[model samples]
Target: MKTFKKATDPNILKHVNALDNGEITTVSLKHIFHHGSSKYPNLFRRLDVTEENLRTQELASGTSFAYDVMGVNGTGFKYEKDNAVEEFRNISMNELKSSKLDWRDIGKWLPAIKNWGTLINLAKMTYNAYIEMGQEDWYDLGEEYSTNNTFGWEEDGIRGYVFASSDNKTLIISIKGTSMGFGAGPTVPRDKENDNLLFSCCCAKVDRTWTPVCDCYKGGYSCDKTCLQDSVDGESLYYGITLNLVNSIYHEYPNSHIWLTGHSLGGALSSLMGLTYNLPVVAFESPGERKAASLLHLPHPPAIPWDKMNIYHFGHTADPIYMGSCNGFSSSCYIGGYAMETKCHAGIACTFDTVSKLKWSVNIKRHRIQEIIDNILKVWWNLFKLFPDCKNDDECEDCGLWEYIE
Candidate 1:
C-alpha cells in the first residue's frame, strides 16, 4: 500500500513498462530506483528493487509477466538438500512420459496420486513426531484417522468422516476432494465403550461443471446473483457441519473447543467456516476464498477480524493452485522470491527450486503443488520450533535471521 514517489521516475518507469510489456530485465529492475535524482531525491531510498520483490510481483501478476528474481536465502540450496525438487521433477517427467491419456485419465490419476502422497507424507511426519516425543505408547492417530470411519456423517448433500483423540478435547475434520460436502458431530460411545475424541471428515460434491461463482463469472466488480448463491451454499454447508459438531458436543460434554482443518479447496472452505462461525482453523494448502467470503459478508452476523482468525495457509513455492489469480483474496502477504531469506534456509532453497521446477515443468498442477509444498514446509519448520524443544520457548523474539541475506 506504500506509494512510491518515483512512480514516474524514468528508471522505475522503464521497469514497470518493461514488466507490462513482458520484457523486464534484471538490469532494468536493479537500476529502477536510480532514475530521478534531484527532482526525486528520496526515490532511490523508497524504491530499491530486489530479486525476491520481483518474484513476489510476478506472482501477484500471475506469472504472466517475466521477471528475474534471485533467491538470496539459502532456499535455493535447501531444495536440493531436501530432495523435494528432485522428487517433483521426477513426478513431472513421469507424468509427461505417461501423458498418452486424455483429461479424463488425468483427472482420475491426479486424485489418486494426491491422496496417496498425502497419506504417505502425513504418516512420515506423524512417525517423526512420535520419535521426537519419545513416546512408545502414543496412539498412531494419523493411521487411525486414515483408516477408521468410527465418526462419520452425511446430511444436506454433505458427507464427512472424523478423527478424534483419546481425550475428546481435540478434533480434526478433513474434507476430501473438491466438494462442499463434509461430516459432522461428536463420536457416540459404541456399546459401553467411552469415546475419547470427536472428529469429522467431509467433502463437497465436486460439481466439475460448477464453475466458481465470482466477479469473473459476470465480469463485474461485485458478486453477481449466481455467485452469491454459490458462496452462500458453500458457506452454509460449512457452517452446518461445524454447528452440528458443536451442538452434539454441547448435548454431551457441554464444554469443548473445536479445531478445524482441511487441504486445498477444503482449506478454503474451512477458513470460510472459521471466519464466519468464530471457529479456529488450521488449514493446509488452502486457496483463498476471500473474494467469495468478502462478497457474501457474514450472512447475518459479521465474521471475526483478520487478527482473530487462526487460519494457517500451508503451501509450497511451486504450487500454482495456491498461487491464484493475483487480483483475488489470496494476494495478501503472499511471499515469493523476495521473502525467501537464507536464515530461513528451507524457504530460500524451496523457493529457488520451485522457480526452477516451474520453469522446467510448465505444467500447472506440478508447479502449484511444488510451490505449496515449499511454503508449507517453511511454515511447518517454524511452527515445529514453537513447541518446547532443546532451545528456548521465548515469546516475541525476532526470528528474521535471514532478512539481511537477501
Candidate 2:
C-alpha cells in the first residue's frame, strides 16, 4: 500500500523553496504525499494510490480541487508535442528571412483610412502648428527630433526617423510619428488632450494593413474619405522608410534583441512591422488593426511563434479610443483568460492597465522605462532558474506565458 503524508507540514515550503532554488534534483511522490498528509490528511489520503489510478481519479473528480492541485491531464502540464522553437528556426532561416523580402507589401494591404473625420481635424492641427512655427522653427524642430537619431531619406520618397541608444542594442523606427498627423507643435501633449489624437493617427497605419483597400468613401461615415486618400499615399512613403530602417538594423546588429514600438499612428505601423517582419513589438494603447488587416488576407497573430514577441498596452481607462466600435468591432469584447502557467502565442498580446489610479504615479512615470527593462530582466532570470532542468522535449519548455502568448 502506498503511504501518504500531510501537505501542510512545515517541510512543504522548504522542499518547494529548494525546488525553486535548484537545490534539489529529484523529488518523489512520497515526499509530496508525506508533506500533504501531515497537514491535510483528507487531501493527502487520495494520493495514497497508484499513479495511473490517481490520474484517473483526478480526471473523474471533475472538481476544481483536482485541477488546482494537479494540472489538466492533456493540456496544462502535458509537454508540447510540436516543437515550435525548432520549427520557427527552420521557417525563420528560409521562409521568413529577415532580409530580402519587402515587408511593405503587407503594409500596402491595410485599410487606407479609418475614422477619417477625426484624422482630418488632426491634420489641421498639425498644419496650423507648421504655419505658426514658420520655416526656420520647423527646420529647428526637425533638427531637435533628429538629434535623438539620424534622419535618412528612403528610395520610396519617405524620410526616416531612426532612434538608437548609444549601445545600439535597441532601435525605434518611427515610420510615422506625431509629425505624420500634424507637422509641428505644440505637438499634441503626451497627456489626455492629445492622447486620443495620437491614437487616431496610429490607426492610419492599421488602416493601411487591415482596413479595406478601396478608394471610395461615402460621406456621413465617421471616416474622412479625403484624409483616407492622403493616408494611402502617406503609408506608401512610410513603408519605404521602415524597410530602410530594417535593413540598417540587419547590418548594424546581427545578433541583438530588436523591438519596434509606437504610439497611436506609430503603433499601427509598428504592428505592421511585427506582423510582416516577425519582429517583436511593445505597442502602447493601440487600436485593433488586425481586424482590418485580416480583411486584406493578412495573417493573424497565431501565425507567429509566441516566444519572440510581446505587445504591452498601457491604456488610460478613460481614453476615448477604447470606448467606441471602431473598425466595425466593439472594444469591450472579452477573449478568454489563460492559466498563469500557460505559454504565450506568437501574435499580439494586449495588456490593459488604468494609468491614473496607480499609487506610485510619480515614481512610476519617472522610472517607467527602467521598470519595463527590469521586468524583462526578471522574466529572463526566472526562465533560466525554472528551465535549467528542462530538456528539449520537456513539456511547456518556456518558463511562463506572456500576455501575447495567452
Backbone N/Cα/C clashes per model: 38, 35
TM-score per model over all chains: 0.36, 0.35
What candidate 2 gets wrong by more than 4 Å, as runs, is: 1-167, 172-176, 179-214, 218-237, 295-297, 305-308, 322-346, 349-406
> Which ten-residue region of model 2 has the weakest summed lDDT?
67-76
lDDT of 2: 0.29
Quantify how close model 2 is to the true structure by its C-alpha RMSD in Å: 24.0
Poorest 10 consecutive residues by lDDT, candidate 1: 191-200
User: Once superposed on the true structure, which residue ranges of model 1 sit more than 4 Å away at CA?
Assistant: 1-157, 179-231, 234-254, 299-304, 326-353, 356-362, 367-406
